[model samples]
Target: MSESKNIEVSGSVMDGMAEKGGVLESPTKKPPTEYTVYPIRWLVLFIFVLYSASNSMQWIQYSIIQDAVVKYYGVSSITVYWTSMIYMITYIPLIFPASWLLDKTGLRVTTIIGSFGTCAGAWLKVFSVPQDMFWLGFAGQTVVAISQVFILNVPPRLAAVWFGADQVSSACSIGVFGNQLGVALGFLLPPMLVRAQGTVDEIAADFRLMFYLVAGFTSVLFVFILLFFKAAPPSSPSAAADLGSSLDSNFLQSIKKLLTNRNYILLLISYGLNVGVFYALSTLLNQVVLTYYPGANEDAGRIGLVIVVAGMAGSVLCGLVLDKTHRFKETTLAVYVASVVGMLIFTFTLDCGVIGVVYLSSIILGFFMTGYLPVGFEFASEVTYPEPEGTTSGILNAVVQVFGIVLTLTYERMLESVGDRWSNVGLCILLAVGAAITAAIQPDLRRQAAQHKG
Candidate 1:
């Protein structure tokens, strides 16, 4: 039976009991009791983290394919841009809706549906395309993106509920670090696999290979979900205590509460712009490498691997710093500042010996680029109330994605009109703005948290 139908029937029975003069002791029909479940919740979060990690390969693999795609597909630079863009556009907007679905249906069903969609999308990429492969890849990515709506937004809320507030940021940071590691490995491995084949077709083979690999990997997580994942039983004390209070909160009120907080709004804008610049730069990095280092003549797979490896280190370092310090704003602002400086180096110092320039820029960019995830989500979590954390997070995720839409359009036009150099300069400016905004809101967010705690 459907979850909604089950809920309705349960409600009717409860009402009938009350009408017959029976005591309505519990909001849920079941008894209030604790469990011997120990710490299964952390295990569940880890599984979900792996699920998110597997999907990261789908997007991050683009960097590896950058040259192969340009060579085989004979397309413009914008082609790789949209491969990442398709997924971003497809997935980011769905965050709010995914959160709403989680509230209504629970994680099991939502995750299953997303997992299936992602798997199917991956399989479709096996065949060659008639038009721009962007649309075909996009169809698969759309599924992954839509699936991600559930995967990305729900986790931190789950972390908050299962692990409690003090551990929330740390748990989240670890999970996100897993996601980046997947991205790193995705970039690192594909080129080597292609090289072993001893032909360009062998390299081309990796695209189809990634689809099957990521799909099969992520599908395994679904089995774990089916076996171990469940709604908190009605008999659980937490469920019983929350039964009435859950009904009392409205969607509109939750939105109003989140928006009215000035600090939260500022953080959202900063994150959105930050993501916009990040995506734009990531998509363009391969082209930048080719332009500056003419002899490097490396495939997209190799270049992408280097960047992803650097990014992996950056993500872990960022998580460790935030977990230890609990200073969300300081961490984010510092990363943004570093990224701005890195973008400048990539643009202005292009003629300096390629190795010194590229290596320094990549290391700095990787270190600063991905660090935003840890602190950005941490900031969002602190601003939101515990109950509505999912919804609030969904909104923030969607807003950042909207900025991605702008970045997509602007990156393409700038790439064509002025050149890669100017396109990057614009990105540097956005990073600077993001840092400024994040820093500005730091004092306000600290004050609000103090007020809420007091």
Candidate 2:
């Protein structure tokens, strides 16, 4: 009777019984528990970094070959400047919608959208170059700039999602470093590839080649991301992994909370000013160098190279230190103070015609200036924990874009009126104000550490 009843029991029911019993039993064997671990978060990070670099490469492409572009397209310097300025200008309005997209959807969807937009923009420029179609190129840049709203907002958020707390700052730094590297490459490559001395026809040819090369690279990266990029790992990487979702479901409430946070507001202002100065300087580097050293287009590129390289090194080093020390406030303050001093030196020495001093001061300034970005991003993350990192970072970047536009225009006009020397003097005053604001920020590292530990 027992054997007959056992045979009558369904295999499906038995399997359910086994599952509830915490072990599956069989006549001959018992199966072992299985667990899966995915550790390709770093690989995911690298993909986004490449995407970031590609997007940024487009930002300064026109500015790098400023004279050649101006000559080839038969445009005013201001019109040529708008090619890059349009990027900063467009970011002002689109960032809010972009933040909503990132928070509501996960990283994979948002990043893919950004990646496709970038590839489209790059290819559009490739077509635009052959005809010397200024409007077409501007339209392409506008599209690429729109993509930047997505790409630039991801570093801190990506670091949080993909890396453990110990490596969060370092990962964010690497991500931000990608953008800086792109800018460096953008500044260095064009001048070398499209010679200032070349004829209009020759310059136009080189420009077309440059766009083709960039578009090709961007397309490859886009394909890689489409295939391999995952939204996140299977398991949570850190205690704060879910913090973004833990925020109030009400979007307006979340924004209100973030605005009311004192530390965040202070850091926002300071970071904006610092990044604003950088935007002004980068956009006007060629003009400033040419004003002092005429026909030194190659030398201007070299100067950009040194400044960005030093800045990259400084960014990584600062990230490593923050990882170890978690000294967000002190590290930020020190960098700000150092930036002010370096900027002062660079400003006063610009017209002295001493190439060595200009190089030295600019490198020093870049080291501290660019280094502040990662620190600011990470610091804001710490201060605004439990609030979405994307919201905080996105808003911060939006504010920075506003500053960039304002300062870039101000410096451009000042360049016309007073000169590069006085324009920098105005910048140094802004830096001093930034350093003071940074000094006032008081982050709750203990709470942040506890949250990460949890």
Candidate 3:
């Protein structure tokens, strides 16, 4: 029952013989088989977009308005940071189980688990926020964070299950766009809804309103997904996608394949560095901005919005480009290097005292940095062809979360001891190292090669 087959990507006999939706394909099937793309695929994608946003909203809900949270909850700034930090911490343990569930139980069951978690977590906060109960609020966030394990890895699988080979990259980006949209609103909503200038009672009232609204929204999403979401279409959307599930059926074996792949290992390291630093920077943006521009709490929130909104555009654009070019390595390296330049500029401009310049810096930084997410996911699928999308995506997400926790702690320490200049400079250096690693990877483009044969 145990096997580690080295698959050839040239439309070999084994490729034609792979099982799809638990049914064996015709033996007469040959290279370049025609595939179907259902209209229902769009509907499934829409449901995914909604809940992905709902779940991702919790990632930065407290971090954007850290000042208000600290005052209302009567906690330290570090305690406020942990509300967001715990998401990364919880993800490490939960991802293994979540991936197992994704492989075993399939998409519908695993997806509903995330929707239920999001709904439950949001409502739980509605109960706790009115009381200024920080522990209860954190408990709710942990539940949401746990839900992310199911949600984050869904995009790649969603794309491959429903989209054609040419459209998979763009579909993956559109899927991730939901999460970035959640983050954009997460940045925009808190400062607009809750103000740090208010009294404790006033702050609690504002926070209460925000929680009730999100809770109601997630409640609606849970019902929608319950009725509509399905695991896969009637047939595979692409030739490569036919083997997507069966090849990854042995979850443990898939892990072994991905961990041992040289290109995948490099992609994981670079992804952790670039994306992890983005996580720390976003979660702590208010802190960084507040240090120099005191009393500009709302301004900090707006800047956060600018960062993600720009990233939303970048992600869509990057995905579209990759769909056409399939230039995985070139695009990834370009984005990573641009992210470093953007970071250095942001580091200098934070002290420039002009908010407009800061906004411009955030746009440049977020566009590529956030955009790099889809590129990384698609590239992972490419480098580890024939591996299940969920397993590959899950491992990629875990690496970033680990680095997210480490880099966040490191940034906090440097911000305290050496001040803003050095803290950001340090992030830039780590990113450069990541860029060099990315440059060194000579990916085989196995998935793209298979597409040509098919």
Top candidate when judged by lDDT against the true structure: 3
RMSD of each: 9.2, 9.7, 6.7
- Note the Cα lDDT for every prediction shown: 0.63, 0.83, 0.87
Which tens-of-lDDT digit does each residue in 175-226 have in candidate 2?
A: 9999998888888888988977888778878888898999999999999999
Instruction: Quote the lDDT for 439 in model 2.
Output: 84
Off by over 4 Å in 1: 1-37, 60-64, 73-80, 128-136, 194-206, 229-248, 295-314, 442-454
Model 2 off-target regions past 4 Å?
Answer: 1-38, 130-132, 242-249
Error of 1 at 243 (Å): 12
Model 3 segments more than 4 A misplaced: 1-32, 130-132, 246-248
TM-scores vs. true structure, each candidate: 0.78, 0.90, 0.92
Over the stretch 153-272, how does candidate 3's per-residue lDDT look in tens digits?
989889988888778999999999999999888888989999789987888889889999999999999999998988877667776787654463688888999999999999999999
What value of lDDT does candidate 1 attain over all alpha carbons?
0.63
Cα lDDT of model 1 by residue, 239-271, tens digit? 222332255556667777888888788889888
> What's the alpha carbon RMSD for model 1?
9.2
